[model samples]
Target: MTSPDDSLQLTATELRMATFRLARRLRCARAADSMSDAQLAVLADLRMNGRRTISTLAERERVTAPSMTNTINGLEEQGYVTRAVDEDDRRRVQVEITDAGAELVVETIRRRDVLLADMLADLDFTEDELTTLREASVLMRRVTDR
Candidate 1:
């Protein structure tokens, strides 16, 4: 005796649960490998965008300036990142990933993909389902970009 509105709400909740579970699993797997999710995210950003200022990174990551500073300090200590003064403006500083940082990011990405592939292998998904999932991933990326 449920109404159409109830059915739609249930469907929306189910979708949200599925997304949460998948993201949680992926994050847990990544964490178990000794890399913090925040660090990996920052590394990925640097790889995609090259050098960036600390303020820009803080904004992009939706974190405060001090938090970004601490994160960058940790990465610097691990030799994964370095900061350099702007040649034209000594007051400005830019952060860049080192060779080791790039390598670590690539390795981490491969590991995550392998983990996801293993998980997906057991799912009884058809071709259409797979295609839909791929398209949904693209849309999800667009949503996150905002």
Candidate 2:
């Protein structure tokens, strides 16, 4: 009794809901691993992008300058990051992640991977299903990249 258009729309809606639920669950599981999400995000950014100014980091993180300052201060107190005056411009402070910070980023990524692997294992999905998921991930990344 249902038209093909209705069937297609229902399938699309289900896929969208499933993807949203999976992402939400994964984020929650990752958060439970250790560091707060903001701390982890900052560390990961520094590890990947090297040194940056407080203002730059604030812009990238979509936080206010004062909030970014506080975050950086906390990180420095924890010995995860260091701030030094730029040699060419003494007034400018550049923030860099220390070796310890990089280690934390690596550990965080490993924990997330473990969590995801466990979830994938429990799914009992076929190889085709995984390939489809992989393709969907690529599409999702492309959409975000814009």
Best by lDDT: 1
Worst 10 residues of 1 by lDDT: 26-35
Give the TM-score of each candidate. 0.86, 0.80
10 residues in a row with least lDDT, candidate 2: 26-35
RMSD of each: 2.7, 3.8
lDDT of 1 by residue, 15-127 (tens): 78988998787776542266678888898899989999889999999999999999999889988899999888899999999998898888777777888888888897889
Encode model 2's per-residue lDDT on 1-146: one tens digit a residue. 98999998997798789878876766665422555677777888999999999999999999998999999988888888999999899999999999988988887677768888899989899999999989988977886667
Candidates in order have lDDT scores of 0.86, 0.84
- TM-score for candidate 2: 0.80
Over 4 Å off, model 2: 1-24, 27-34
